[model samples]
Target: MAEEKQTCYEGSSVQSFQFYLEHSGEHKAILQCVHNLLPGEFKRVAEGKSSLDVLGVGSGGGEVDAQMLTLLQSTVPAVPITADIVEGSSALTDNFKALVAKTTNLQKIPFAWHIMHSEDYEKHVKAKGVKKFDFIHMIQMIYYVDDLAESIKFHHSLLKKNGRLMIIIETAHGGWDTLWKTYKKDLCVHAITEYRSSAEVISCLKSQGLKYEEHVITNAFDISECFNPSSQTGQRLLNFMTAKDNFYQSFTSETRAGILDLLKNKCSTQRDGGVFFNSNLSCILVHA
Candidate 1:
């Protein structure tokens, strides 16, 4: 067996992680996209069945988890829920706890917060000590895993029969796809790894003997203000573009100029007051 990799969140100070969460509205939007794609009947079945147990892998700050819990409560009031958050970051876990404490609806659901890496969660289940969950969610965090197949298999093992593992990823064919594919040389140092697409995920799941339902949700981000040097978003973008060593080293002078030019053009258009960057989010609902 291969050694498990430590999670990104491990050993990070809670304050630093909290700062990331505070600026993570974009991530929250992504979670909302996943929540919208979840099967309605599953919510009903979860409510009608025994207590619904949910596990959120890479659940950062619990903002997304809180939103999903609200949706569950409103849609399936009878399903008693116990949400176990498996987070790698202690700082992020603290932020998640604070968010839970502040949110009334989240308090209604039986919530257990676990500060551990995904591999640890898998090991716990393999020991046959943990209860099977009705739903398992991993949103936007799959890219960090060293072994995607093993991660999926672990999640599959955690589910009760007929339970669903819903994963959302950035598609390889979206507008963001173009940006990452082309600029990763310059961007990889600062930005995260390219995510697996919906098709790739489906194929992988099928290879593991898991049946799944998949869908893509497209959304756009307006970042016109981010391009303007005077605007805060623009300044942020500028700093992000210039601060990373990989970005500066990866692109030729001309290519770097072109990328910045594209950013400027996209950011300045007044018709929408921002550049509309479209993203295709792939949601895979797996039956384990």
Candidate 2:
């Protein structure tokens, strides 16, 4: 809104995301879900294959992608694996490349990194038109796509027989979701923004008569700093949460107070001397 002096996808947005991740701490439960689910899916996809083709969309910094790929390699150790990762931020792409350079464990897995958004990656692959993958994952990435339905279909089409497409997204009932939904019209004015949850994805799959399984990853984080109106760290967390500039100052005093009250009473809980919000996330396994 207000022409967005700085949007969430360019410039320093990479630092914004890093700050959010650092403040949110480790999402162990989400990682655990991936660890538990990917092995079985890898076995299913690699059943009759000697090699694996995987795609990662919006694979920021390649942290989760590395984890999932490592698990897949362990599950089907004999199968050679190739991965094509798409990311929009060059800063993040550089970080991923640096991580890849130092991580000896991932050396055996050949990676093709495309430092671009999901829509461009779609256009890139359409030129070849003959490529398909045993596994395709869009981790915390569905929000940044230009066309939600077409993007989902495009990825689904890339799945080989019995292959799995995994999507990780925020749950509809989290503090982030609560904030986004309330301010959705403003935040989603950007071409790269759309706030959708696993439920929406599941509904889309069901509407298309596709098969899918859903797993909810329940987690929480201490957001006590957000209550402090003067804390810069708090501001960074709030900026990432809202993906908006001048969040508190932009709102009317009455509106900001209401928002703070709603955040505490409806979206989070008080525990262990910290204000924690249920940053619940979910993963949907769409099968081909």
Best by TM-score: 2
**Candidate models: Cα lDDT each:** 0.67, 0.79
Which stretches in model 2 have alpha-carbon errors above 4 Å? 1-8
Each model's RMSD to truth, in Å? 4.5, 3.3
lDDT of 2 by residue, 1-288 (tens): 223222245666787888778777545676899888777778888998978899888788888877888898889889899988888777788888888888887888888888777777788789867468989988787877666888889899999888899988888777767877776765566643678877678778888888888888888888888889998877777777766666787667876777677677777999888889778888889999
Scored by lDDT, model 1 comes in at: 0.67
Residue pairs in candidate 2 whose N, alpha carbon or C atoms collide under 3 angstroms: none
lDDT of 1 by residue, 1-288 (tens): 654455554442343344333442456666666566654846644744867888899888777778877777777776678888888777778878898888887877777777777767677767778877888899877866657888998788888866888898867566545565666665544325544556567778889887887776665555565445456554444333333323445567787677766654532233544466555577777877
> Cα deviation of 99 in candidate 2 (Å)?
0.8
